[model samples]
Target: MKPKKKSLSDLGGIMYSTDPSFVYEEENEIPEQALPNQQQDLRVMLDKKNRGGKAVTLVTGFRGSDEALEKLGKMLKTKCGVGGAAKDGEVMIQGDFRDKVVDLLQKEGFKVKKSGG
Candidate 1:
């Protein structure tokens, strides 16, 4: 499926260049490689600001691919038996499981730090 264009800039600025020699170079972005578990620095914290006062354990500072992040999120959710989301390089596990999350991440070989209140 084609993605919806949000603005004129999304369509590329130079739509029709009169010069025959003009060549439009498309931007190619390379996805970052996932770091090894031992090399990863992760932070686990408790957040309750935006969720109607219900706390969530937030895991951040993950320098890896989205798939890896999702996998880690799934593992945490399964172990904690809670529902959450993994996106934008962050994992949100329902409830304040900061201590458990830290232990799990540490077991996975990630250098984890407990931050925030």
Candidate 2:
């Protein structure tokens, strides 16, 4: 069997800079906030692979803060009467609720569309 690939985080402090004068100092620049993708069209897809044949409604194209994502996720879960999580700029609701989710997103002034077969 092939060995699994190591992610960047897996390296864990093993990185080294080759430059002799490379002074590693954390930047003091202010971080820019993520703007919500309210005007962007979002895609709602039903994914089953790698999930033991169970379906999940994946709402993608979200660009905003984690708080916003969680808020939206909570609202969707409540509306659908199901459980789910929001992370990495995506909202995942348990079960296949593509149509319902799309409708709800549209009603919330989001440009959402049901995607995938």
Candidate 3:
């Protein structure tokens, strides 16, 4: 029987392998089923709360990332020339822009859902 290969520790206790095909580590890959849950996407919703008597459109269902909401808020504010804010994974635009916002978000390939009274 042949002797087993021994690994060597280089400087500062770093390990090295003579084999070129050896990989020390691999990336953390997420499962396919968890992809949707882990997706950094957003879903839009219409909200009607104490919006200072103004009709506010609420965008929600974001997968934990606020980047899209922030960007969308900016775009909507600029496009509609209205004011809006992104908070708690949701964006609130100051107006009843459900139809227009839905169209814009759909055009950008986002699954938007409107909800309100």
lDDT of 2 by residue, 1-117 (tens): 112337855444547889998776643645436554567568999999899999999998776667788998999999999999998768999999999999999888888888888
lDDT at 21, model 1 = 98
> What are the clashing pairs of model 1?
none
Candidate 3 colliding pairs: none
lDDT of 3 by residue, 66-110 (tens): 465477678877777789997665678888788888887777667
lDDT of 1: 0.87
User: Where does candidate 2 stray beyond 4 Å?
Assistant: 1-38
Residue-by-residue lDDT tens digits, candidate 1, 1-117: 123458869768867888999998865646677789998889898999989999999998887777888899999999999999998889999998999999988998999999996
User: At residue 81, what lDDT does model 2 achieve?
Assistant: 100
All candidates: TM-score: 0.76, 0.72, 0.57
Q: How well does candidate 3 score on lDDT at residue 16?
A: 68
Look at candidate 2 and give me any clashing residue pairs: none
Residue-level error in angstroms, candidate 1, position 19: 20
Instruction: Report backbone clashes per prediction.
Output: 0, 0, 0
What is the number of residue pairs that collide in model 3?
Answer: 0
Candidate 3 lDDT (Cα, 0 to 1): 0.63
